[model samples]
Target: MPKSNIMDTYGRFDVIFKKGIGCKLYDDKGTEYMDFVSGVAVNCLGHSNPAIIEAITDQVQNEIQISNYYWNDKAVKLSNRLTDLSDHEAVFFCNSGTEAIEGGLKVARKYGKIKGGNKKNIIIYMDNSFHGRTMGALSVTGQKKYQEDFEPLIGGTTNAKFNDIEDIKSKINEDVCGIIIEPIQGEGGVVCADSAYLKGVKALCEKYDALLIFDEVQCGVGRTGSLFAYKKFDVIPDVICMAKGLGAGFPIGAVMTNKRASVLTHGDHGSTFGGNPLACAVGCAVLDELVDNKILDKVDDKSDYMVSKLKKLKEKYNIIEEIKGMGFLLGLKLSIDVSEFSKRCFEHKLLLITAGKDVIRILPPLNIEKEDIDKFIIKLEEVIKTF
Candidate 1:
């Protein structure tokens, strides 16, 4: 291994990946590894997808980026598609999930001011929720481990126990402005919000005239067998913060808002590199693949196939405690050390990620085939036997 001047933020693996194809990565030494991580759910169509490549190539030949002062046709097309697919009426494009969250927070606060003056500025987040790592988003993220180092975060933020409607009811008041939640908590162990719990929270937000913001960064964009996770939950939110799979690894984010939550005026918030031609082209391509090609229709059957196999694995190994999450955003709650388990899987040429302390997050590509899944099971079971 050779040393370089990269940031020490991530504890990186020793392997140097040179290239990737569908559901697989090739190292510098020409070794192949099944990529189950999918760049932590960003590569929905898998690595080096044709649609993404074509979108990039086409947009690059014309123009890669243009000033925000002028409207890009690609951005307008993507925004129109997104709004048509969901209940949202408007869209604010950004560069990443955290930026989307930050913009959504500002929108919520402004809406609160408009509705009930400055007193209604409190934003409620859920316990164990992972919104983002930026200042404003970090303040709303419920995990103290991510917040403690950056103390004195933005004010007017409170939290309630996840899946506990009573706790949330006690937490909400007249001063509450908005409530942000993940339909499926990704970094918090792939735990899902109960349907009834989400409905109850929506009722409370409606009663208090507070905007309901759904952070679907990880679970949306057909990862949950639906365009938006809120669709499956049967609870429509005032704002939806999206990113991850939106650009299919091309780096884009958006905040979709309804009429009430669209409070950002002319000079409220903006992104310099956001909604550029190249990124928006990729975003449009991803949506076309998911919607026009009927890619989302295949998700539910694949989920059933994968979960059944995982349950059988659970029956076979005592270390496998439970299966959590939905569709492609699944997790294996192991009684053994999850980090060690993940490391061993990596050693055997399988890439994966860990959530919380004990769960192994399984985020495969949306377009991955069943043969690859079967191969993953075989490799996973082989790794388990070593433990």
Candidate 2:
């Protein structure tokens, strides 16, 4: 075999995309694709959205960044909007979902140290939960594949089975300080925790004085037909970690916390480009569109339509085992290998991705058009025929 020029980190796809507009993307050869992946749920408003482009461009013309040493109007405004939308009393911005997770962990540990001393540093995480790739985030990421070589991971983290209250309760102890979970597990095959299960977790957290942290990095920012997925369950968390769609393609992440868990004093945690003006400007624009344009309500309608189509497809194709997730963040379990089905869909001009071994993850832009969805269904049907 010949050596490849590029580093082999990601499983490389052959197709090269040249440009994207709305829910469709064009390859270098001008072939078009119905993009259901949406950059793994990052491009919430679709590609090259006018509002996002205009906001980013205008901000660049004026100012792009300012150190935390000085005040930035856009950052302040974005923080205010985020805090106002949730029960959280404060917000800390960062560049990616992982950074936000890192910040959240720091806050949790700091709170433990301040209130319970250093002994109470243990944090509970779900078995299949994914926080991030960074050390602190990776430490709590319960998947072993990502942690295989990383020895001596941040200590004081334990894994409990998702949706099993007994398993979670068994793991909790006096040393535990927090319990972090994805309201809807995005990367772990789109498994949603039962509402009763979430409520039970909340009760456990309350009983043990453990902070509840919702990692809505993928299923948040109006992806689940609400500003945050926790809202759907009516369970407010002590700290909420969000990213992906918050900036609608621009790099931004935030940790939103209510007053009780807002224990970080000055100099406890900080980031260099955490709340830069440009990213916040884009974040505010995305939020305004989500709220003022009533985009949140549309998420449920579109999700229902997609689910209906998928159910019909499921009947026709025995390969499909189940459909899971809320609103637009859907997962399709397959009797066949998901990688094979995903490749078939991609070859048929429909972009898709695999979540776990046998799950087809569909994360189209929140504002995707109905026509494009219909076309995707047609293309998917064609792909399933060959599969």
Candidate 3:
């Protein structure tokens, strides 16, 4: 990237993808690669899906952009669909995951202040967690590395350990407004919170009258073989943030809230281009493919197959330390250096992404074919042999 034109925040790869279909991607020079990352799990139905294409073509022709001053049919449809799929009573759209997190936090604060007055401003997060990079999101993000230089973020944010119910319980106080957590820690190496632990957290939140927020941006919209990862556990959060795959491939995020959000009178939070016609139309189409067409029903078998194959590879190669994550979001913990291995995989025409510090994450498109998975295994085996 030229410094004159573009910023250098992301350590992006050199390859420029020109096109993609299903789980297959092609570079500008027409070199085909098996895409296992799916744009970091954004394209749930894969690239240029027929449904999204139709939605985009039609909606772009009708209306591309609009201010939030007026209501639109597509926005209402998308919001209704999302709220129907989840336990939320209402939804708020935003531009990205970080924005969604920020919106949720704001709602929690507003709701808390109404219930307990000004003292209830504290929000608790987890260690090794990632919500987003925006200031409000960053304040609650647990890792100090991401929050250090941007010191003095929004105050009243605390940290707790994953799966440690006692630690979470100890942090609960009258001043605490809410607690946010990822049902599955996608950026934190695909770590899954135990069911019992989530239940305990919910109980604690109730005991303290604190709102519970689940950050499902990376694991929602059937990415985890369900509409949202929160369904895996029996507990329900008062507020939840979703993005990444929510709009198929469009840029959109939403904050879903239960009835507790009634405390938010008006103008508590808003976004200008959040639920515009183009994005909402695409979101509706994505939901049609996943929910109406029953595409997610096929994810279980595919996830099981992926796990079976990965374990087989583990049995064959001792370099594999363990397999983590649930459903389609998987991670391979390796005893060997992953940077060189991932680079080799890229050179071998297999796209992959790493998580945390030591794990290789596989967040492929949800509808990837079995043969494509086999091909991924073949390429992975070939790449591992070189190490």
Highest lDDT model number: 1
The local lDDT score (0 to 100) that residue 291 gets in candidate 3 is 84
lDDT of 1 at 206: 91
User: What C-alpha lDDT do the candidate models reach, one value each?
Assistant: 0.94, 0.90, 0.89
Worst ten-residue run, lDDT, model 3?
Answer: 1-10
Estimate TM-scores for all models. Answer: 0.99, 0.97, 0.98
Model 3 CA deviation exceeding 4 Å by range? 1-4
Per-residue alpha-carbon lDDT of model 1 for 100-186, expressed as tens digits? 999999999999999999899999999999999999999999899999999999999998999999999999999999999999999
Residue 33 alpha-carbon offset, candidate 1, angstroms: 0.4
lDDT, model 3: 0.89
Best by TM-score: 1
lDDT tens digits, residue span 1-387, model 3: 324457668777787888998888998889999988888989899987999999999999999778888889999999898888878789888889999999989888987888799999999999999998989999988888899999889888888998899999888898888999999998888899999999999988888899999999998889889888889777789998999898877999999998876455567778889999999999999889988898899998999998999999999999889999887899999988887788989999998988888899998888888998899999999998987
The candidate with the higher lDDT, 1 or 3, is 1
Number of backbone clashes in candidate 3: 0
**Number of colliding residue pairs in each model:** 0, 0, 0
User: Of 1 and 2, which scores higher on lDDT?
Assistant: 1
TM-score of 2: 0.97
Worst 10 residues of 2 by lDDT: 1-10
